[model samples]
Target: MSDSTDLPRFPQESSPGPTGPTGPTGPTGAAPTRPGTVNGAFWAFLAATVISIVSGLLVLGERDSLADAVRRSDAKLTAQQIDQAATVAMVAAVVIAVLIALLYLLFAVKLRAGRNWARIVLTVLTALQVLSLLAGSGGSWIGYLSCLAAVIGVVLSFLPESSAYFAAARPVRR
Candidate 1:
């Protein structure tokens, strides 16, 4: 008689068969839902960044006005000095605008990731922006629009839906 050991294991010895239903499945968590506020904030920040870049370009375009303003503020400044200062200011503004745009993007990403600190930081920055806009003499429409976008972003971040998402993301205490 053939020994049982001569035969391969049941499944291993058999030819491939039709696949059957798998075993019990693990719990699947609820589907992730991105809040509208987060999306709004992201777009608003992007808009603000574009507006800031445009405003910087506008400043460069009106270099003569900037130099004149500087001269009026400081009578001792010669034409050459005023021109130099205007150039410096334009360069500085461009650099600052780029940096601000990058900062806004970072904040938007962090905020979307449910970072409470990012939300707080963005709110503080928005408040500072609004304050600065209020304190300074207004210029181009771009500046006002940028400030408005910042304000909208801040508001959206504090909406009830946003708050709920943040709360959900927060770790629960024992």
Candidate 2:
């Protein structure tokens, strides 16, 4: 007889074959409510990034007018300083937005695919986001909302169905 290792790998070889009648097939659709906490976190971060980008672009577009206004004022700030400061702020905003977006995207993929380490990262990120809401400017209602969304996402992603989906999607370790 051939060795077991030489045999073709098959489910039937390891388990009993179907003997009972099959159940009716249900309509195919996406699994509802998989741990989308990761998705939520990603979206929240994305929104924040977009907001920063748009705000930055707006500031950049109005830089000249703002500088003019400042120069017209009694403050009499130098045009060079005004231009330099605006440029610096615009560049910083763009860089920060890009970095946050990239990081969120990476976490989103991991959470979507159910990587174990992703769960820890997501949790930490969520907590930090929530803390930022409290620590940041009180007038930033948007930041508060975004932080709330992240918290919700993390909670949803940790649900049983979500966890199972992630586990199944994760790579099978040899």
Candidate 3:
């Protein structure tokens, strides 16, 4: 038998096996590179989240005006009843806005990681926002801005490169 040092050393014994750091496939198999389009979509979705928060705060700022409007619209409501109605509406608005922002953040992160399901969910949400605006929901300019960003994000998610990246990552990704 040969001496220990005379035998093939660790580095010479093997380069990289199937379980190497680069993985079984090859180099770049560890993680698919995120395309520019997917990255852009991520940023757009993040911007939409920020816009939604700001819009929610602005709506909250108009709480007094909302109460006045409700008071004017219904002549039969007592002062306490009007206040309660305004409070309920405000709470509903806050809940809806928070839910929307949370969804955007969750899906945006997954989309950046090349999740096709996230892309689809984000697309559906964008459609809903557009439809809401078109249905005369009395959206403010800020709402329109948020919708525009979401639309851009969804569109980017469907680009050819983005689609390919998502597809490739699905097989190797967990």
State each model's CA lDDT, in order: 0.76, 0.59, 0.86
Q: Write candidate 2's Cα lDDT for 50-79 as tens digits.
A: 554454455567667756665666366676
TM-score of each: 0.73, 0.59, 0.81
- Compared with the true structure, what per-residue lDDT tens digits does model 3 show for residues 59-132? 77888999999999999999999999998999899888899899899999999997899999999989999999
Two-way TM-score contest, 2 vs 3, winner: 3
For model 3, the local distance difference test gives 0.86
Tens digit of per-residue lDDT, candidate 1, span 31-50: 23558887898788778878
Candidate 3's displacement at residue 111, Å, is 0.6
> What are the RMSD figures for all models against the true structure?
10.0, 7.6, 6.1
Best by TM-score, which number? Answer: 3
| Candidate 3 off by > 4 Å | 1-29
Model 2 alpha-carbon drift over 4 Å, by segment? 1-12, 15-77, 170-174
